[model samples]
Target: MTENPYLSVFTLTKYIKRKFEADPYLRNVFVKGELSNVKIHPSGHIYFTLKDDKSRIQSAMFRSAANSLKFKPEEGMNVLITGDVNVFESSGQYQLYVQSMQPDGVGALYLAFEQLKKALAKEGLFDERWKQRLPSLPRRIGVITAQSGAAIRDICSTIQRRYPLAEICLFPAIVQGPQAAPSIVKAISSAESYGSVDVLIIGRGGGSIEDLWAFNEEIVARAIFSCRIPIISAVGHETDTTIADFVADMRAPTPTAAAELAVPSREELFERILDRKRSIYRSFSHQIKHERKRLTTTQQSYPLQFPERLYRPFTEKMANLDDRLLRNKNDITANRKHNHERLDRMLSYYSPLQRIKEESRNMDLLVERMTRSIQSDMCKNQDNFNSIIRMLRALNPLDVMERGFSIVYKEGNVVNSVNSLKVGSTVQVRLPDGTVEADIKSIKMKDKEEDSNEQ
Candidate 1:
């Protein structure tokens, strides 16, 4: 039998892989294409096909290179890929091993920023409602920035100039370069752990977007959002905006501006205090003038000037009532006397004596009956006079006062209810003996339920 002349499939694939590796053009090639058939493996490797209108190439990005990518690689995305063309032994096919990948026509960092901004926005991190409010007067201000940078100096100086009482606590962090994001996040955590800072200022001086990219990082943004203390973001100049700014309680145009926002101006506060004092003085002065005028008017009034005249009318009315009662009593007594005399005259006219002469034995009985009748009429008239006198006494106000009851007067008006008077009210108590001035120390109104139950 003759030996096979053809090479095995494995041997052929190995030779092709060696050829692809040795080629200088394929070793470091840059290709631009649309991504397709993208799949991320559990092992952290990414497999995809890079395609154009007419051609397609299978590609693989190992974990090491894929980890460096700023933005996620998605299917159908147009990308610029840099890697070596290599052959896969198992598949017996050539593929590109991606060293790095980026979205074509845009900077990697900018694309990453946009993609993160969109994602975080969807999660509501950038919503205005999530932002904290800055304290009006911060006793202690925390600053997170590079210790040696102009940002820290500006913040400290501005705060000191505006509000000398505010204490400045610096959380020195790397504000630029690769380690900046984690450094800022660590500083934020440290501030939280300290827990005494009223406001936190996180920022750097003006710089390029690349120089200020740390503040745009998601970790830093999240740290600022989760911080209990209010945060003021002041990264770069007025034009520069970062994700931290959106998530922060407030955004300042500069580091100095952030410090100003953190603490109130001493001069402005003094002015406010002065204004308040002046307003209070004016109010008190006006109130005093009004009270004095009222006092003067009350002192000169007719009631106070001639105090005795106030009760003269009541005294006269009482005298008239007494006179009318006396006249009524005299008239009632005279009417009763006249009626008795008329009854006597009628008895005499009946001439019972003449009838007695006719019957001497009936004379004693008639005389006894007439005496009883005259006694009965006198007794009835006396009883009626006593009843009238008793009724007159019962209707007298003095009689009611004599029974240990008193009339309550407030401001010359009768106090019929506790609701009409309050605590500290002046009142007059008219008793049987005399009128006593009193003040209401306290008043408690009876509840509806209690009144109903009592009734």
Candidate 2:
């Protein structure tokens, strides 16, 4: 059998890629779809998906084509894309190589506005913490917009009507088109160079997003954020907002509003000053009245109106105290004289002769008491001795011998039992009258005759 020739997988892929290149329709195709998974790489290449409700295709825009885009692409945004459909040789995948793309339904300017707004917002450029405070009353108002436009005219007239004393310095700028952003920035820097303005009114009259896009430029947003002078953004109508509005210190709906915000009304300020002056005068008057009333009361006080009467009571009180002191002194002297006489009599009664007689009598009484105590103690001891003598006689051993019991002794030691004596031992017997000496003979036991320990 013969083997049939077959192509390799890579060869088939290369063939499909070549077919895509050769087909004129696929080489230059137009696709209308909603953008999805849109991503712009650091290398300036854009990767995204072009999808309709029913289907989607992988799409890519190289850096060259992407640089020409005036508006940023976003996911879920409807767009019309011009590109070539081809097979990615490496992966064998069919995809779109996009060259040009523009928003399909919405204006490209609006898309760019939203895209930059989102990016700056994420960067915290729109944070309220970064917003500066508007000056209460600016000395010179710096206006950054076209010189001949209605925006500048409105701002100047409004300031003149509300606060006529303010100085308006116009930094004439191109307020529309590609050159508007840089012109506005240069004007801002110029205003800063002069350094006379207290606050800046950077805005234009109401216009479309494209017409007002100068303020939406990134340079303008950065300039507003970095401005030393406070900025009041007045761009477009009340319903319109831009990147400049978010980055500015304050946002006014109109150029007139922005001018009003930069300066205070002379009428209101005058009224406020008058109110404060009236308050201060009222306080001063009240204080003066209070002090005057206090002075009147002091003048009518008792000490000031009746000085003689005030001292009369003190004089009478001093005279009464003098009389009482004289009486007290006379009584004190009489009492002292009586006490001295009593003390003299007491000294005479306690003379030395009388004291000696009393002491000698006390000594004689003490000696008699001592003699009686010694006699009573001797009698008590004598009676105790007689009673002890009777007890000793009752307990005498000779008394027991008189009852026919005798105490035996062996070699001068007392023997109370016959078993205590051995044969041929000399013993002494103790009787009531005298002691008799004897010798111990042979011992014999009488059977059943006598047991001294038997019951």
Candidate 3:
């Protein structure tokens, strides 16, 4: 069997890539398609798919080429693209390496502007709630535009003419082409860095939407939206609209109008001040007349004309109240006397003297009972004590000794038994009056009858 394969998958893809690159028509092809799945890289490269109704092709725009684009590329935009068509080696598919792109029919800038407007609006960037109010009288006006452009001149001149005290500081920027958006953003940042601008005028002279596209850029719109200084957007003619107009603090018809919005006209202000003075005078006159009428009416009124008459009702009412109070006081005194008499009678009826007498009798009785009890307790205790003392005296050997009985001791111990006395032992004899020390002569055991009787 012969081998069926002739080439690897990479070899076929390489061949196709070489064929695509070598073709003269594919080298620089112009195609028109609607953009889809567009993605912008942080490195400024662009990746997107170009699609018509029936077919699509992958496309890439490098940073170098994309950086030159006058408009931001967005999805679903019908655009004319110029690029090289070649097979991407990794994907093995032919795609466009985009060099440049332009809107097919509608202006690219207008499409970009509308697309950005919709996107930013969806993100709540264009909400009226986020817009700041322009200062009524701005002290410092920051102008962000080309210093050479008519916008700065118109703004400065208008501000000077309308309100000469307004200090104008210029932040020079590129107002057209690809560099315009970043330049304007940097200018705004620079303006903010200088730190004294009360209001900012961002604009360019009348031009095409493409010429004013920098104002439409997302960066510029965000910069305008984020500015701490109130911003007035003036781009192109009155009819021209951009994203900057939507996000700025105020949108003016033209550069001159922006300056007018930012600063008040001195002449008009002076006229307003005059009108205010006239109004103040009229108000003062009216107030003075009204107050004078009030004062006159007050003076003519009965209370102010006759001071004693004003107090007549109060005096009469006070007299009536005093009369009623006197009557009430007398009645209250009578009633209080009656109540006091009734209370005294009740108190007498329930007086504690009887209770005290009864208590005293009961206390006396209790004292008598207690005295009898004490006397009986003392007599009984005395009898018991006397009986115990008699018993003790009867049992006492000292009493026996006083009755002429003696106590015999052998070596300071009692000799209760005859066996306790040893012959020839010295002994002590204790009588009631004195003690005798004697020598033991004999000791004999007593009879059993006598010992038993003694025990």
Candidate of highest TM-score: 3
Off by over 4 Å in 2: 1-24, 34-37, 51-56, 74-78, 86-94, 103-106, 306-455
Top-scoring candidate (lDDT): 1
Pairs that collide, model 1: none
> Which pairs of residues collide in model 3?
none
Provide the overall lDDT of each model, using Cα atoms, as 2-decimal numbers. 0.91, 0.89, 0.88
Better of 1 and 2 by TM-score: 1
TM-score of 3: 0.66
lDDT comparison, 1 vs 3, better candidate: 1
| Candidate 1, 1-455: lDDT as tens digits | 99999998899899889988888999999999999999999999999999999999999999999888877788788999899998989888899999999898888888888888998899998888887888888899999999897888898888889999999999999998999999999999999899789999999999888899998888998898888999999999999989888889899999999988899999999998999999999999999999999999999999999999999999999999999999999999999999999999988987888766778868778999999999999999999999999999999978999988999999899989998988888999999999999988988778999989999
**How many backbone clashes are present in model 1?**
0
lDDT score for residue 342 of model 2? 97
Clashing pairs in model 2? none
Better of 1 and 3 by TM-score: 3
**Which regions of candidate 1 deviate over 4 angstroms?**
293-455
Residue-level lDDT for 201 in candidate 2: 87
Q: How far is 326's C-alpha from truth in model 2 (Å)?
A: 26
lDDT of 3 by residue, 81-164 (tens): 899998888878778999998998976666666778888999998899988887888788888888796788888888889999
lDDT of 1 at 66: 88
